[model samples]
Target: MQTVNLGIVAHVDAGKTSLTERLLHATGVIDRLGSVDAGTTQTDTGEIERRRGITIRSAVVSFTVRDRQVNLLDTPGHSDFVAEVERALGVLDAAVLVLSAVEGVQPHSRRIMRVLRSLGLPTLIFVNKIDRAGARVDELVADVRRLLTPTVVPLGTVRAPGTPGASYRPHPRGYDQRLAEVLAEHDDDVLAALVDDLPLDGDRVDEALRAQVAAGQVHPLLFGSALSGAGVPELLDAVAALLPPSPPAESDPRARVFAIERDPSGERVAYLRAYGGQFRTRERVTAYRREPDGRTTATRGRITRLDVVGAATDRAALTAGHIARVVGLTGVRLGDQLGSPAGLDGRSHFPAPTLEAVVRPREASRTLALHAALLDIADTDPFLRTRVAPDGGTSVLLYGEVQREVLSSTLVETYGIEAEFGPGRLMHVERPTGTGTAVEIIGHGFFGTVGFRVEPGDGVDYRREVELGSLPLSFHTAIEEAARAALDQGCHGWPVTDIRITLTHSGYWSPITTAGHFRDLAPYVLMQALAEAGTRVFEPCRRFDVEVPADRLGPVTSYLSRLGARLDGTAAVPAGWRIAGVLPARLELEAQRRLPDLSSGEGLWSSTPGGDRPVSGEPPRRARTDGNPFDRVAYLRFLAQPPSRPVAVRDAGPERGHRSPR
Candidate 1:
């Protein structure tokens, strides 16, 4: 049998979870239907998810449908937990976009559709809640066509009378009038058949639709009520009959681990999508994981367990186009590429970690333990980054206030570690303002000394140049790697970015000063170089895409002005105007908060962090620290660190009231 990885996605309360439940029960994957309201759904196994009645993590369940074994991913609909959705998208062969017939196309759904298009995944539109009163399928389709894809066509007749226990047949008039034109536009053969005939044969239509869908030029629209089990069987049949099977995983041996989980016994489980060869249990694998140095390494681990998702049996081997759980990989992380990576980057456009907060244990004695635990949590959720302070306090990056609350609760209930986070703040980075050069020397019998010139970059390159007299060619890699690590954090507390470090001169004694010594001392030397180079603050900016009516362009531009946005340009869109620009990320939130009112409920907006922009209105201030590289006393104080303490945590509810520590 063929394999398919289908993702069911939607805006909150659009019946995405409900659709999953109906599909599972309808396909006999489960005996009874579970309810999201009742908190009894099979895939939402997390305690918090069950109680909150929302999916926080993407979960999988498998079923055989239409002659294919399909692994269905139920993704989180809440925009706050969108990272979860993005992770699942990386493994999807195709997607089912769930939209409400009554509520129509929502903002989050449109945002998701944008990403789906960018990834070029075949998509099927399921207009759910057809049985609901006041549902307007035509209006919903129009919104979908206007905002998402214009080529979306209705696949089968909805609400038409047919023989009981038989398949849904397309209404000849609807098919000839709407879908036929769409198919004809895409395939000359289909157009020939349509012109030469009256009504399209179902098989011919299915073949043409599948071809276009796979090409991502057309998306089939199906209508249904997942709750009433109305039109669900047709949706299932459409997926099985119209969608293409995934590319075989056995073609390559590489797999990407998109998520990580812990079993009840605390054994780590990694959710992997085999892009290539088969994975056998007890096989020693060469794993490649992205490191802090921004490179992948050969971290070897043995796979001790292999189980198909939602299946009871443990399989000795798993192949491509399959999602499975494996254990005993000690060094794997959320985006690690297993089995040589085979030219896979394993990096997606993950949302930047913008919110920063200080964390400490409620008990002062567990300071070091608390710090370690925070890093552990960050490893699981890459969006969360940890910063350790000299005072034994730790800080973390977060998405929003609710995420902060969720992290606090998880720390307490899951890890048995209670912690409180300071109020989250916008994370800002720093960069050098002017060019400068500095030198570090090893006296007497020591091996070598290094000199570097640091300067601001034009945003295209951040590199290290080796000038003449740079030790042996083999030693350059060690020095380059060390210099990059040192540049990670600049003169200010913020991370350093967009700067070029050139090796102006090198004096080395090859015998004593090994690569290890150069690697160890390069950071200290680089720090001094950056300090002499001088530094300035840069705030995070977001790139915005907005669409509104032509008449509403004035109000939109007016709103952007208030948000301190620099308008890149605007173009004519079918609905109205398409505006693009860069704006302060802080104001991006403000824009989100007030968009409905500004757009009068008819506008669409999306944004992603666009990296750092220099302080425009005000003279930029420098990041402050007590023992920074510029301060020699503090630099010496850094050498004697680490007298740990136990920590204490207080329950700060969903809305964190504190600010990140200075």
Candidate 2:
């Protein structure tokens, strides 16, 4: 049977979980429906999720639909948990974007659609909650077209019994004929049929619709009320009938680890979507992940166990077009390529977190335990960044107050350590002002002279383009890796971005200088190059859309302008104006607090991270590490430490973790 991986996603409280529950019930996967509020959800099996009535981790379940096996991944709805959604997307055959009929298209819903298009994932639009009071399927459909895509066409509409429009209907297989002209504009076959006067009934239109949706050229919008089960059956049928199918498997066995979880037995479980061939228990596979020093280390491990879509344990192999939970990869991480450990093309789509906090246990003795516990559970919410700062302080990046609370509660419940967080500070990054080089010799318990040239540009992480023959493969690899790791923090506290570096010299005795020497001191020399370049800090900015009463436009504009904002444009809305602009990310929170007062509670705002701009008021962030690379005494002082000490994590870029949802 053909298998399809479908993800259900939406903004917070848009009825994503409700939709998942209704799907399972409609498909008969469960005996009865589960409620998100009652913590009775099947996919939301995590304690944190059940208690909070939200999904923090992606959960998978399988059911057979129309001779096809469907592996449904329920993704977290809150933007705070977007990393969870990104991980889910990497393995999905297609996606379903759930939106509230009453609220229309929300800011997050639009952002998710944009991301879905960027990834080239075929999508189906479902306008949910049509039974709710004030639900306007027409307006919602229009918003989906305007904000998401022009090709979106409704399958059908929902109206209350005795109401003015079409009443609620189920199993309506016929395509709305009025939309055929629009379909003809995109589908050649449909246009050919129309031009030739070929008889086109619901069957012909159905064929056209299926072909278009499978090709991703057109998206069919369906109206539904998950709460009342008004359109649940049709939605299920549409999922089985409309979305694209997985491509034929390649000859070679291939898969990518998209999420990582640890079992209570201390076994490392990896969630992966197979792309080709099959993976069997006891099969040896190459694993790829960045070491703490930033090098892509390759290792081989035997698959100790394999669980494919909750199949029988006797099932020994997982074929292509399936999702599996396997154990025995000690080092695999989110986005790790399975076939070749040498592949570095694997990348994570999660955005950089914008807020950070220093977290410390109330009992100082539990510091190590706190770090270890946080690292383990941190995968539940990948954006909840837990990293050791350059100053040896442990910190976490959060989405907002809810995340901080969740982290604290989770830490206490899981790790048994009471913790508190320091005030949150907006994340900042710096770029080099100009080109600079470091060639001076500096050694710490090793012998070698390292140097690199630093230049500023667009890419976020470090890229090496050095002559391979200049050094041995291992030494060359270590230099590139160490140099990238060194950029974790510039001479300033903010993370650094958009830089190019190339190795210039490695002066040392080839036989005498160990690879460890290059890895350990490359950061020291790179810091020298960065200081020479004289960096400038860039503050985080956001692109915003603020909806306000038309008469109150002046008040909102004046308010945003004072917060160092530059208005991009403004459009008229039914009740107000949709003023769009760019502003510091910090100002967005303040606007949320003050806009209601200024607009007399009629303002709504949405924002996404924008490119950084030069700092206007804040000074350059201070470096926590010793500033001078040539200072041997201070450099050695920083390097000498206990064996258990975890080095400051390198700047190789973001890595996401998988969660068990505990």
Candidate 3:
């Protein structure tokens, strides 16, 4: 059977999870339908998700549609969980984007569509909730074309929409002139037939539609009510007929692990999607990960357990084009390409979280437990970076307020920890302002010596002026890792970014020097160099879009202006005026909360990460999570004591919050 990895994606509460349950039932994968409200959905098995009726993780479930074995990925709809959607995108062959007919095209809806188009994934737009009251199927198609892509072709129409009996009617063969025109935009045969006023062949049109859909040049739009099962059968048929199947698997073993979850026994389970070759249980496999230095590193691990999706038995082997739950790969992480680096880059698809808040344990006695729990949670969602200070203060990066709430609840429900969150703040970074160099000679306090020259660059560029083989690979790696870690806290205590550092000199006492010696010496020397170079702090900013009644534009703009937003342009949209601009991420929450009131609840607002800019005044400082490397006495004192467990290292390398080996 052909395999299809189809992702179900949408804005929050668009019935995406509902659609998954419906699909499973329609394909006889399940005996009864599971409701999101009742919290009985197959994919949303987490306690918090069931209680909150939300999807926090992207879930994979398998079912069959005729001869096709479909591995359906139900992704989180809330914008806070876009990271989950991004990971899912890396593994999917195609996608089914669900939109609510009642809500029409939402801001997140447009954002996801843009990402889909950018990735060139063959998509099937399913306009759902047609049976809900106030649903407008026909108008939504127009809205989709206007707000989303203009190349979408409506595959069918809705009958008795906005009612309980709402149903779908597939278009009759050769009846859609728009379909011909859409195809003709790229098809020479169709264009010739249309230009010459020649009769178009129905068979030709049907064939062209399938080919275009598979090529990601066109999207097939379908109407359905996942709640009532209206038009669901037709949607399933369209999925089988329209979307492309998995490409032929190559002979080389290539796969990517898109997600990681802990099983009931607390063992880590990695969701691996194989694109080629095969690996059996007990087989040793090499996982490949691209490092920050543009180099790929390989780690070998034996697969102790493997269960293929849709297999009747616990499949001992994973083949190409199939997803499997594999355990005992200690070195594997989400988005790690196994066997070969043949998949998409696992580096962040979206910008890092712009907002951060300090999390204080309500009872000071529980601080250590809270920190440990947060680190454990970060293992599953790497984007939820947790930072810890020497003073025991802890903070977490956030996407938005909704994610904040979910995380707070998760801590209480899962870890039984009560915590208070400080007001959100923009995550700022520092960049080197000039060139400076420093050197630490051997025997000053340790057996290793290191020197580094620091200056501005495109990103965290680590180079070596010293010869490659002058020291052992492990020692070199240790120095590089420590240099990057030291930059986590710059002169102003914010993480340093957009900087270049070259190791100018290195020395180690032949028998006495260890990797730890270089690790300890590298940070001290690098920070001193950074202090000499000086740095500038930049605050995160966001690109925003607002639509409100023209009459409300003045107040909206005024409110935005007060938030220090820089307006780029204002144009008249169908229902209102559209204003676009860049706003400080720190003020985004206030703007999001006030826009509805300013427009009498009709204002629509959306924003995306717009990079960062230098602060206008004295730069703000974050508490240093790394030992204060700039203070030589304090840092050496810190190194003398037993090292405390590090908090989850976000955007940092190798050591990613795991406890060091004894």
Best of the two (1, 2) by lDDT: 2
Cα lDDT tens digits for candidate 1, 569-610: 998877888898999887876787777776778888777657
Residue pairs in collision within model 3? none
Clashes of 3: 0
| Tens-digit per-residue lDDT, 278-350, candidate 2 | 8888899987764433347677888989988844223677777888999987767776767755335545555
Which runs of model 2 end up more than 4 angstroms from their true locations? 161-167, 170-177, 189-199, 289-297, 310-314, 341-350, 378-384, 390-392, 442-446, 458-474, 510-512, 617-633, 640-662
Q: Which ranges of candidate 1 are over 4 A from the true structure? A: 157-175, 190-204, 250-252, 310-314, 431-436, 444-448, 454-482, 502-520, 531-536, 542-556, 567-582, 588-612, 618-626, 643-662
Worst 10 residues of 3 by lDDT: 653-662
Q: List TM-scores for all candidates, in order.
A: 0.84, 0.89, 0.92
User: In order, what lDDT does every prediction score?
Assistant: 0.74, 0.75, 0.84
Model 3 residue 358 CA deviation in Å: 3.1
Prediction 3 TM-score vs. true? 0.92
Per-candidate clashes, comma-separated: 22, 2, 0
Which one wins on TM-score?
3
For candidate 3, what is the lDDT? Answer: 0.84
lDDT of 3 by residue, 489-523 (tens): 88877888889999999888998899988888887
